[model samples]
Target chain A: MIIDVHVHTRLGPDPHGFAYLLDQAAELDVTLCVNSLSPKDGTGMPESPTEDEIRRCNDWTAELAAAHPERIIPMWYLNPAHEDFACRELEERLAAHAGLQGVKLWVAVRCNDPRLDPIMRLCAEHKLPVLQHTWFKVTGNLPGESTPMDLRELALRHPDVSFFWGHCGGDYEYGAKCARGLPNVYMDLGGGEAMNGYVDLLVEHETADHIVFGSDAPGRSLISQLAKVYGADLSDEEREKILHRNAQALFDQQKPANGAAS
Target chain B: MIDANAYLGNWPFRKLRYTTHIALLDKMDALGIEKAVVSSLENVFYKDQLAGNRRLHSEVHPHADRLLPAFTINPTFPGWEEDLDVCVQEFGMRVIRLHPNYHQYGLDSAAGSAVLDAARAHNFVVILATGLEDTRHHHPLVKVPDVPAEQVAAAVSAYADVQFLVAAANFSGVSAVWTEAAHTANVHFEISRVQGPVGDIEKLCGTVGADRVLLGTNLPLHVPEAATLAIEHAKITAAERRMIVQENATRLFGLG
Candidate 1:
């Protein structure tokens, strides 16, 4: 079975909604591992969601994961742009959701910005794997969206922390080059319309161990993202690492029982 | 399954994994893809685009039965009728693709209207792409805009007699595009850009009806297995799956 590391809440509308997401994962025999709690819509929050909106989205995500602990793995989303309240927010959420395993950084600010330093230090202290939304768009980027290169810099700065580089920055050719030889970064397979060398190129540069599977589902496709791995004609060992092993290893590092933070 | 939206030639910005027909055939054979309706990437950049069509003929003719070739024309070009005649008469092409974004003209332009008239007269399946690549990641200097879904919807309604194959259909704000055209029987969509299991593919099938959806991978550019698995694993019925995978394409392309 495959583990999807990059799913969002409220994938789409149906009578079932989130229930449908879990049921479909069950039907497809996929494990719904990690989620970026945006809202009912699969698209993430407005680049910088209001503090109250952020609190509400995270609360909803925790409840959804709690209902299906066997299937769902929840990530704590942080918007460092709320620089004044961001650190306090993380502490309060962590105290509340003891088992949250990962950290989600959306496009509100670049990962390397000084604004995120306190957040990064807190994650490093907690051993949380940060899944940052990084894309290099040609048309343009969001006000402060990070790119693979930005993540690469952040990875070098925080060597002990694990980073799931979301969508490999869209253009896999450039993304692969940035990820090559970076042991801390794991290329996320999600969101973008993948091409012929999406997996092979990344594996050639980063190897299968450094690459993980993520279905930006509800907004994207689960099977389609899974097929990016399964259809790569990889060996069993390579497939296993991407399908579940790498993600499981990353998740295991989180200090689940030690959620206390001032 | 038949891959209805594969491409050949250089991408200009980046090198493709497969740029030749031999590689495509080997891939199709391995994946059990019987036939693929293909267009040219090289043509989109060319001034005449007819050269790219001629190049495609040379490359695909050897495996004609399996590689169903489609010709592209810049309908805005003067006397495009002669070019269409060549593609139809000399090349025996059955599909005429348009890249108004690459060709730099509005789909509602007078020249665009003339092409629609030609499409009605020629009775060839007209394949228009919502986009070949995400404009967000396109070369910043190129400044290519996507063919808005509403524009495609408008054409589908106006050219009621011509078969419109919307390739790489954009799912973002799709209602404005596909839902508008859903009422028409002449419009069909290729799933090169659509995904499933909560990606709302079933909703698309429900709205447009299954018979109007065809399987497309945008291959040598996208994963063939991904396209096949999307329908196989979609929530729609097996019969809907069957229609999406091959039957719809077989009927649209007139494959015997």
Candidate 2:
């Protein structure tokens, strides 16, 4: 079962909107996609998604999955800045959608921001893996986007909650090194040049189990991302783990009804 | 195919275990890279670029039939003209590489002008390196600033006689530069750093034309095969693909 863990929907300010993405996902054979909603532009410091918007976005994702039970898996998007709202949203979404397996965070806010602690604790309590938008501070396009160093510290602080740091730190070597000792921290190979011989680095220097495949779709095409991994020199077993097994294992713990391995 | 911007030495951050020259050649051969204009990483990083360039020239000069040498020159250094002369006359170098940001000098500086003058006098093709990766991904303290497109354009405009090749220009920057400098016939853009869908190259070529684009792979950092595949599968006509992949670089660098 192929799962694309990183996808943005237009429930936010994206011009393409949701229906366009749903059609694209269906055509791409994406069995399960974790949809994320971005905040409106100019929503300065602590860019928070409105509670009503979050509910509507998650409902749309849940409905898509319900309509095609075998194809889609909804992930709850949470803005840690809205602490109480985040916890309430997670609780309500989980109760409403039995297939909701995990949560997603943009991590554009400060890594050490105390507001995220309660949400992290709640995710830990629910046994839900959190996919956080992460990169090295050097490569982060936004000023406050969480860096690997920040995520590393967060992973150390919350060792029980699984953290999938997206973009493999944007630069492969440094990101892999930053994530090395943090067992709770995994990396999503998403953007940037598809460097050859990177898989060997992951196997020799990083934990193979800690790596997952997430194509930052819409921004990048699915074919390009898939080709990057497919073209890499990896063993079938390692490829299997990176492509789906690792993600499946992460979601399996949450026990989303249809998320169970086929 | 002649690769205009190929490297023969180690990148400190490369994931693959450093392979011998023969191993690198075998890999390049499999990817159909027949002739590659090579440089050394030490030349790009270390204080003494000549020492590394000398070692690289010695290694590749013997097999000059397949491996053409491009000596790296840090314009910021003292006695750069002497080194440039030695690289061209003594080592038979046809191409000169500039790492303005790494060497701590602006590409538009007085020293940079001297280097360009010497390159023109010797008929050496000049390759301006923008960056190897997104700067935000570099070591926390070790900052490698991008060679700004404006500075590159200024340099290209300043030296109309000498041919200038810009490596690592992004898709948007390439288009912007060409729009203003389209009449600057000496300017050429390398394809390895500018990425998009396969058809993206065709669109770029339509705007800039095929002659101004050359094939380059930031090898050991990026996979050479991906760059080669992009050129190989480009949607343009076969003649245009040949011009981008092999003919243009061959003519620019005089690599037969």
Q: Mind giving the per-residue lDDT tens digits that candidate 1 earns over B135-184?
A: 66677678687888778888888888899888876665345566676447
Candidate 2, residue A230: CA error in Å? 5.3
DockQ of 1: 0.57
Go through the candidates in order and give each one's DockQ. Answer: 0.57, 0.24
TM-scores of all predicted structures: 0.92, 0.81
Tell me the deviation in Å of residue A69 in model 2.
8.3
lDDT of 1 by residue, A1-262 (tens): 6778787875444434455567788886676655545654434557788787677777766777778777777677788889868888777766666664677888888888888888888888877778888898876778788988888888888887888889887766667888778778898987777566678878888999999888887567676777788678689999999988998777766645464210
- Per-residue CA lDDT of model 2 for B63-159, tens digit only, reads 8888887789987777777777787778988888888888878867887777888888888798888887656657766878787777777788878
> Which regions of candidate 1 deviate over 4 angstroms?
A11-17, A36-44, A98-100, A255-262, B196-199
Top-DockQ candidate index: 1
- Residue pairs in collision within model 1: A138-B136, A138-B137, A139-B136
What lDDT score goes with residue B128 in model 2? Answer: 83
